[model samples]
Target: MSGGLAHRWDLSAAAAIALQKSLAGQVERADRLGPGGRRAIRHVAGVDVAFEEGGAITRAAVVVLRRADLVTVESAVARRPTRFPYVPGLLSFCEVPAILAALTALSQRPDLLLCDGQGLAHPRRFGLACHLGLLADLPAIGVAKSRLIGAHAEPGPAKGDWAPLMAPGKTGGRMMRIGAVLRSRAGVKPLYISIGHRVSLRTALAFTLRGTTRYRLPEAIRRADKLSKGGAPG
Candidate 1:
């Protein structure tokens, strides 16, 4: 773990909330991805978690794909005894250890990560993607199936249309931008996109759209989800 974000995972609910608040400030909400100049994003990773043994075990799967063609280049899955109880806002505590293990098993690190959870859109402004990105020091984005916080108008019916998701700021009477509600596919429900670390919201949206084809979620995330649910890894 990075020095600033280093902390224990096993903690009381109050401690977890406090830890989130402390680490949330470390998440960089800026664009720092790709191979610097003229190099396109080549490898992108998707991470998801599933439960087994009636939720006693946490299964984390990571799928790295070729960015241009969305072909699986590498994949890994890790199983660990669930360490924390299901907490609404403290999801990273329950899932990130196994996720880190799975990521460590990969042959090479991906250029970007798409996490199946929230990011800066959470109550503490630090969700699973933010936590994982800080721990791994990788550019990451959150591609959530549903909203965890914030409110927004319905996105347009067409694919690629999006609307800003806003929430009340710490100070009263101020609305802060948290994430975006995106229509990944025309006929399907919109997705919630947010910056996890080292990437801007616009860049996150672009990469997410580039990774989506014929589905409401990105192909990397879809594959990772399947693997996390016990599907064979490629």
Candidate 2:
């Protein structure tokens, strides 16, 4: 085991079949709403990671914001030397450890974890948000700036207007969750969202909308992303 199996993660090629069986039930543990279902909160946190030398060096930053007034409470950063190669589906392998490290150092923990990546919308149903949420045991959602996988329709610019993300069979809801929303604009691009841990699709969408103001991505991700590039890791 790579000790990366903390979530009881299934990484073994031989155990692939068994792992899929086990994950089948766990993925939709949210009952009618599914695993990620939670109300949008005033106190929210953002996490972002940056890599240098072509992802060889990584920096992770986390920021806690008050939903009541949108003020920063706690912020942290973690830097480390990346060991994993830059594979498309395995981004969590490089970012998760540093994100977890930054989360641990937060003095004031936010109610939600807003990550700068994808969640259940991956081939393995294990993206950055899924990895961090499961590890933190908290409500987390992914807000990726780019498309790692799956296909979707164009949404409206008014925000809250989203089209169904096409996923085949069991993986259908992996990208869109159940009621998750995707917003699109002419100049600005749309973002992909999914329940990471204990959150619901409705709540995830609500939070995503609320956190966003005058920008495509939410503040949490925006700040962490900037700090992660050259800023010191906490």
Candidate 3:
């Protein structure tokens, strides 16, 4: 990780919030995955963390899959003590240390990262995905099963339907479009899609739908989730 991205993880809730606010400005929402405006996503990695022993230990997993065939390319896990408390918006601080370890263990870094948490759809606009993307300096997207912040209408029951996620502007200003509510599978709850870093929301959604096959979650993320839960890597 770069020195600017790798900062103090041990912080109080107030300090963490301040850090988030400061770093949020560095998050780039533009598409940076291609050479010349073309799709260049080849490998996508999913990241997740699980707590064990009464939330005292964290098991972080990262699974990389080939975008064309969805074949597992690399997988890694890191276990460490839970350093930070479970604050609502500061989840990255609690989980990212181990996640970085797992990423470092990989022989090949992925082109994109898919996090099982919020990105721009956050109160301070710096969620776990955003933090990881910035730290890793890779194009990343957040595919959360639920919302962390923002409001949106329910999408259609069919797969691929989506609605815009809106939040009240800063300081009670106008409404702001943050992310999207996307139905990844037919007749299932929608997933929250948001820009992490170095990717546009549209490209993030495209990559997400392409990565998803028979399940609501993307294939890479499914594998990572399983690994985090002590299941064998895919």
Model 1 agreement with the true structure over 205-233: per-residue lDDT tens digits: 99899889988899999999999999989
Writing each residue's lDDT as its tens digit, candidate 2 over 1-234 gives 011336433345435334434443454324122223444465788898888777777778898888776677778888878766556867776677778778778875567788887777776676777667666766678777777767776777767777655565563444333223378333467788776766666667777887787778887777777777765322
**TM-scores vs. true structure, each candidate:** 0.95, 0.79, 0.95
The lDDT for every candidate, in the order shown, is: 0.91, 0.68, 0.89
Candidate 1: where is the Cα deviation over 4 Å?
1-5, 35-39
Candidate 1 or 2, higher lDDT? 1
How displaced is residue 68 in candidate 3, in Å? Answer: 0.8
Clashing pairs in 3: none
- Model 2 clash pairs are 30-34, 30-35, 36-199, 36-200, 37-199, 37-200, 38-200, 42-67, 43-67, 77-234
- What CA root-mean-square deviation does each model show from the true structure? 1.8, 4.9, 1.8
What TM value does model 2 have? 0.79
Between candidates 2 and 3, the TM-score winner:
3
Candidate 3 lDDT tens digits, 1-234: 432567887798999999999999999999887422246777889999999999999999999998889999889999999989888899999999999999999987788899999999999999998999999888889899998899899998877889999999877879999999999989778999999988889988888898889899999999999999999876
- What's the C-alpha lDDT at position 185 in model 2? 35
Where is model 2 poorest over a 10-residue stretch in terms of lDDT?
28-37
- Candidate 2's displacement at residue 220, Å, is 1.0
